[model samples]
Every structure is written in structure tokens, then in C-alpha cells.
Target: MDKRGRRRTLSEHVILDAALALLAEGGADAVTVRGIAARVGVAPNAVYTYFPDKAAVVRGLAEHLLGRVNHDRFTDPSQPWRDRVRALALELRAELLAHPGSVHLMLGHPPDGPHTRAVRETLLATLADAGLGPADAADASYLVNVHILGSVAFEVAAPPGGPDVGTTRFRWGLDRLLDGLAAHVATGPPR
Candidate 1:
């Protein structure tokens, strides 16, 4: 306000949007504090007011993106555990693939926001409902998350001109994982 006589204001959402734009334009390395500040028409130092550092900005962007995931599907009490897990996994995979530029960024820093937590909690609950013990449920949820993130990263890294394989590969892998989980549940806890 002193230098340009204009109001000095920056919202977290605005900063995150600009950062995301920078990310899309290049990659993770493109989304620097200076880059985001320039995009927002503010001094580089101004960005610090909203984000302490570049990592915070990246995390903000991740949260903003993950916030778009529809978790209501995980809330249905009547849905079978397998169906619920598969539905959520497929939806997450599609969402990640839609933002190809972000798949890599997300792999390093998984979402820890409230919405992300809700998704994780729901998955844990589904596993518990499937008769997994508390420890097993926690382990299973971690495995599912890893599979989704790892699969998306793999698909995004494929050659740009390669044939579109749809999701047969993903579905096949997911089915095998679910089969294993089913078998594990059927056997009860190890003696």
C-alpha cells in the first residue's frame, strides 16, 4: 500500500491458484515463491505472508486439488466393503490422472487435510467392516493408498503417444489386490 498506493492483500486460495498455474505451466520446480508472487502481481516477500515457504504452497495446492474428491461415496453404510474400496480407488485414480502435472507432486506429499483424513478414515472403516483387525485395517489402508498413488504415477509417466489403455490394467490390479484382501479376511487373524 505504501509503494503503489494499492491495497496489499492476498488470500490463501488466490496464492494456491497461482502456484497451481505455475505448476501446470512447467512442473513442481516451476512453482517457486518468486513465480507465484509474480503471477499474483505482488512482491516476492508478500507471498510469505500467505505461505511460509514453497513447500507450504505446494501442500496448499495439493489440498486444494484433493478437496475436489467426492467422499460421500465412502459414507454409505449399506455398500459392500469391496465395492466401496473399488469405487473410491477408481475415482481417486481418475482424479489424479485428470491432472497429469500433479501426479508427481502428489506422490511426494500426500494430502493431510481434513478431507483427505476423512477419505482415509472411511477406508479404514471399510476394512474394519470387512473383518480386518485394527492393525490389519491400518496396514491395508496404507497399502491401498500406495497402490493408487503408485499406479497413477506409473500411468502418467508412460509415453505421451502411447495407446490409451483405458483402465483395464488398473482394474485388473485392483481386483487382484481385493482378492488378496478377501482371502486374508477369510483366514481370520494369524494364530
Candidate 2:
């Protein structure tokens, strides 16, 4: 039973929700098995039934959060490649900023889940559409990820004037990256 005296179901999703709430309330350190179990109206051992350890719980949280990022815009054939990439970067930034407390999880513990793979594949495809061969697309994808994650990590750590300022800076960096990519693609692989 919960604090309201209502019976609560114990499940992976329930545990994850508790973890997210704890993370939002007090950052990653607050998201422990006991904390989650208490929030979910269960014992610490019960949480272990769903997740073997704290690492697994953190992984689950990462997967759950990354699963929420929308990658559909990256697949829209109508848009130019830069526009598609921009949409993806913007959406990822918005999602990360939405959960400032959890941003570190993304940087420190890259989720190895279906959603993460999907986002990677989508970004690779989008780069390929921009005239990158497979090898170049892979390298470009790494650069793009670094830019987005690095920018968001910095913003979350030391927020600029406001979101607008951070976004403006993000756009400028992304544009420069795209411009370089355009030139590289136009010139073809170097000798």
C-alpha cells in the first residue's frame, strides 16, 4: 500500500518512475535501491527483483529517458539534410534540458538499448543522405553527438543567461559543423 493507503503494483516501470522522481528531486545520488523501494512502497530487496543492482537501475533510467526522444523528424525525406540534422539536435537538446538532473546519465552512461541504437541509426542515415559515405557518416555522427552532448552538459552545469542564450550558441556551433560537413562532402574524400 502507498501513503494514500492504496495498493500499488510493483513493476519495472514503477521502479523506474520512482528512480526518475528521486533523480529529479535530488540528482543521481538520491536514486538508490532503498530510496526507490521506499517511493514504490516496497522493500529494497523487492527492487532487486526488477534490477539486480544500482547500476542496472541507472541503465534502466537512461533507457527510459532516451526512449522518449523523437527521431521521426530525422527520417523526413522532404527536408534538407541539414534541416533534418538540426531537428534531431534540437529535439535531443530539448529532451535533455527537460530533465536537467538526468543529463549527466546521458554523458556518463551511454544507454545500450534499442532506443539508443535507433537514434544512432537514424543519425547515420541522415548523414548518409547528406552525401557522406559509411565511414564518413560514422565519424560525422560521433562529432554531432559530441557537440550536442557537450553543449547540453555545459549548459546544465553552468546555465548561461537563459535557455535562449544556450540555444543560440548551440545553433551557431551546429551551423559551423554543418558548413564543414558540406565542404567536406563537396570536396569528396581527401587524397
Candidate 3:
């Protein structure tokens, strides 16, 4: 340990940065303990000082990428609820599309940090502020995030990558969901 005795011997951040680069160069499959070690010019065992396995590395990458997006797009008191949620959805969609590999990693792995909870909590709080009950708020949050992930997966798995099929479909579906939310918001409340 260093003078402070606080995580001085290892640098998880460096590993994460290198792993992200490898992810961009290829995909999740391109990241391995040996590969990352080579990328960082460290011994293979050096990786185990931080991560336990390849999946753990991917999990870290997922958390890093997800955390980079502005989850606060959900709960900005400055914007109206409909516009806030729509903007949140669209912004998140664009981020995921830019890093399709991270989306895949997130879909396969469970979230392991406060950053992930922050994302969901932001969405949940925004829905509550918009007058949804807890159960309905949860469902609405699920609807938006799931569609984003599902749409990205479909795009990643598809071919003929020139038609914009996935982007067009996801945008249309997201707008329809927003339309339903607007109608609900207009009703004021259920009797």
C-alpha cells in the first residue's frame, strides 16, 4: 500500500479505460484478461487484482458507459414531465446506440453499483413527480428502459445495416408510449 494505504497498489480505472478501448475496437468478445493485460502492458495476473473474470470486466464497462449518460435527464425540475421523459428516453437511446457493445454487456449482466441504482432512481422519481403511483411508475420506467435495450439488441443482431430499421422502429415506439403517458397525464388521475 502507499502512504495513505488506500487502493494504492492497483488501478482499476486504468484497466477500465483500456477495456473500453478494446470494446470500441471490436466488442465485448475482444476483451480478455490477457488482451487487457497486453493492452496495458501489464502481466495477466495484474488484472485479477481488480476483476475476477471476463464477465466482471464487462460489468465494469457496462457500469462505466451507463454512468456516462446524463441520467438526470429524468428529473430536471426545469422541464415539463412529458418533455423531460421524452428527452430522457431519446438521450439514453442515442447513448446506447453509440455504444452497442455496452448495451449488450448490460443486458447480460446485473448492475453492481450505486451508479446503476442512480439511473433507475432518477427515472422513478421523475415518474412519481409526474403523478404516477408507485406501481405505475415502476411499470412506466420498465417500459421505457426495456424497449431501449431490446431495440438495441435487435439492431446489434441484425444485418442489412443500411435501412435504419431499428432506429426508426424504436423512435416510433417510444413516441407512442409518450403519447399514452400524455393522455394519462391529461386525465389528472384515475377515479
Question: Which number leads on lDDT?
Answer: 2
lDDT values, one for every candidate: 0.81, 0.86, 0.79
Task: Give each model a TM-score.
Answer: 0.89, 0.89, 0.83
Question: Distance from true position, residue 105, model 3, in Å?
Answer: 0.8
Residue-level lDDT tens digits of model 3 in 1-191:
56854452448888989888887888867778898999987788889889998788888877887788787656777677777777777777777778767777787886677777888888877777778878878888999888888888778767775556466788799889877866776787722
Off by over 4 Å in 2: 1-7, 159-165
Per-residue CA lDDT of model 2 for 11-46, tens digit only, reads: 899999999999888987888999998998887999
Report the C-alpha displacement of residue 131, candidate 1, in angstroms.
1.4
Task: List the RMSD of every prediction in angstroms.
Answer: 2.2, 3.1, 4.4
Model 1: weakest 10-residue lDDT segment is 157-166
Give Cα distance to truth, residue 26, candidate 3, Å: 1.7
lDDT of the structure predicted as candidate 1: 0.81
